[model samples]
Target: MKSLILYDSMGGNTALVAETIEKALGARAMATDLVKVDKDLDIDVFDYDLVFIGSPVIDWLPTKPLMDFVKRKMKAYARQGVVKPSSPLLPGKFGVSFGTFAGPHIGEKEALPMTMWLNSFLEHLGYAALDQWLVVGRHHHNKEINLSGRLGNIEDRPNAADLAVVEHKVGGLVDSLSAWCA
Candidate 1:
């Protein structure tokens, strides 16, 4: 099925997850496209059967660019012909939300709510928000908060193990999507 992965990252952890997902989908994906959300993003979310969105959680929220993309795209999708009159998303579309966070205060807990917010954007667009993924990243801004350097020690977070998990999740999601697409 056609798939799209959109991401915005500051610390690079979220970008790694996005790239991993793109690689895992590979040739099985009819057309897999990866886009880095920015001020000039020009995309049609309704064009894809499956969409994976990710961002770095900053201050308990998604990066501003990612949030802006969703808001802008939702308006654009509404004006598109393929979007059903009674539905928010194109029929038969699905979505997944993911994020990375370096919360020295609560570690992975900080990533959860942010991912949920990202998923809600898809939900509002009538897509069945399928899953949410979170990855721990090294905290650079506040070394004091990361006293133990717990997650900070890992030089390259969203590292091999984290990527492997992404691959596995993508495989599972594709399996389920295949059944639905068929």
Candidate 2:
């Protein structure tokens, strides 16, 4: 099995989550790689059996770059495959999405309103989202310390305790993904 993790982070929270998932999967014969989302990303997604994407929630939705990456990548996947009569966008692979919010105030309320939109877009592009998750931590927005609905007063970046929760969540996601691939 092979897996890839693509992410865009402002405070490295999302990157840490991706790493946790990769470690938890522990694929013996898997080739796993992580990359920061680039403007001119030229990755080949067909080679991987599983993919994980992490993005910082902006304006209660995924950042524009993340959304654009999803759209472009999915479209590229579709373009490389045989086009069906009705459906045009479809990938030959599967993937998942994750977001990291501040503290513990992550609800569908405002942290990630674009979650569904991105998921639907993935499906439209032919990629199957294996699972989705959200993590809580400290994030700065608009140059101010803004908690995306999470609790606790974070004076600085997430400490070991905060990272542990993210690790646990990602570990679970990895377990479920491994079982799914099995």
Best by TM-score: 1
- Candidate 2 ranges beyond 4 A from true positions: 26-29, 81-93, 103-108, 141-150, 156-162, 173-181
For residues 81-179, could you state the per-residue lDDT of candidate 2 as single tens digits?
Answer: 632445444434666777776633444355555555555654554567766667664665522444223454554445667566756765665566668
**Model 2: colliding residue pairs:** 90-126, 91-126, 103-137, 104-150, 104-151, 105-149, 105-150
Which residue runs does candidate 1 get wrong by more than 4 Å? 27-29, 78-90, 142-153
Score every model by TM-score: 0.86, 0.73
Measured by TM-score, how close is model 1 to the native structure? 0.86
Alpha carbon lDDT of each predicted model: 0.81, 0.65
Model 2 TM-score, 2 decimals: 0.73
Candidate 1, 27-86: lDDT as tens digits: 354579999999998987768878999998888889999988877887776676444555
